[model samples]
Target: MSYVVTVERVEEQPAAVVHGRVDVDDLPEFLGRAFGDVLRTLATQHLHPVGPPFGRYQVDGDVFEVEAGFPCDGVPTPVGDVEPCTLPGGEVATTLHTGDYQRIGAAYQAVAEWMGEHHWQIAAAPWESYVDDPTVLEPRTIVRFPARRAS
Candidate 1:
């Protein structure tokens, strides 16, 4: 899998989010619950997702702190574990990854290498946009990192 990382500007997006701290091996189940709850909250509040589901992750030891949700048309009323948040607007280093999620680390590595070669620094936490359905034979995800000049 080869990635062509590029820099582009993104607009801030309102979202209904659910944050969780779970074992790395349990992330998928956690994301399922989070996304489902967020969707339910959106429906109840009459807010709609503007784009695909997205998640931001940070790993520590064997656990991951994940913030998962959807880029929605409007901020949702906080309900259950869902709360309103914004996907920050700024220039980003991004690339699309096509393959199994198990090998997605390669895509992140590609973005890091590309950024190092271009002298860019990640200025905020990175995220993944779940762009394709799970049933798709080749699932695609967009990986992005908010960025700034190295110095």
Candidate 2:
């Protein structure tokens, strides 16, 4: 599917997250568990979430170092592996994908293609913020890559 990539400035958002180095095959389960942990942490600390859950990934071979959590209104007291972290704020090349999670890679591909054609250099690990419930037939997911124009 084709995507219309946009460059937009986003503010850094505080989040409570659980971090892990997970094999690709186990990512789904890991993210589910991590998200649950984050919610529990927020509840224990009486914090409210601000937005949809997100998973930031740094991939190496088939293993990924993942930070999975929900954006929160205020920083929460650390709970076990769930702690506070800030999502990077800056310009990002992004596109929305609406379909199965398995095909979300195409959204990333489209963003990368747009970035390459525009001489935008990736400034950090890319991430995806899921914007709708997975139970929906065509849920929207925003694929984002932090970037800067290359000299």
Candidate 3:
């Protein structure tokens, strides 16, 4: 349960998301295919691993966000390539997870439970910050869920 503090801005993003119900059991295969698809499309565009994508945030059902990034300077490799958009920075609740994307759900559950205890309302969608090369590392991601103390 390692965690780090960070500040990120959410920019105007139109990246294509692999929308589906992804459980711990389905991560590896899904990530492999998703990254591969994103990379293949973005040939000249280098796919940077911001962090491992795991965990679940219930915006409308449990939505799971995954890794890989396409910065503003980075050319749009795929049709759905998302540029670094505007992200509102403030006090955020975050946690880090190392290895096995399947176990990410527990991390999300942990954060949600922690929020409950602290009386915080989830303000936005949960996002995973990739910290390594998905093509290289075993996989490590920072799960951040925006929150505000409940009134």
Cα RMSDs of all predictions?
1.0, 1.4, 5.4
Residue 95 local lDDT, model 3: 77
Better of 2 and 3 by TM-score: 2
Winner by TM-score between candidate 3 and candidate 1: 1
Q: Model 3, 1-151: lDDT tens per residue?
A: 5444343344433232333446545666766666555545545455443323332333434543444333233335336533233233555678777776567677777777877777887887776665665565567767777888899
TM-score of 1: 0.95
Poorest stretch of ten by lDDT in candidate 1 = 71-80
**Candidate 2: Cα lDDT at 17:** 91
**Which segments of candidate 1 are over 4 A away from where they belong?**
none
Location of the lowest summed lDDT over 10 successive residues in candidate 2: 72-81
After TM-score superposition, the amount by which residue 32's alpha carbon in candidate 3 deviates from its true location, in angstroms, is 1.5
Instruction: Return the number of clashes found in candidate 1.
Output: 0
Tell me the tens digit of each residue's lDDT in model 1 across 1-151: 8899999999999998999899978888898899999989999888898999999989888888899999899878888799999998999999999978888889989998899999999889999999997678899999999999998
Clashing pairs in 1: none
lDDT of each: 0.91, 0.91, 0.54
- Best candidate, lDDT: 1
lDDT of 2 by residue, 1-151 (tens): 8899999999988999999999988988998899999998898888988989999988799898999999998987887899899878999999999998989888888999899999998998888998997789899999889999989
97: Cα error in model 2, Å: 0.9
Better of 1 and 2 by TM-score: 1
Ranking by TM-score: 1, 2, 3
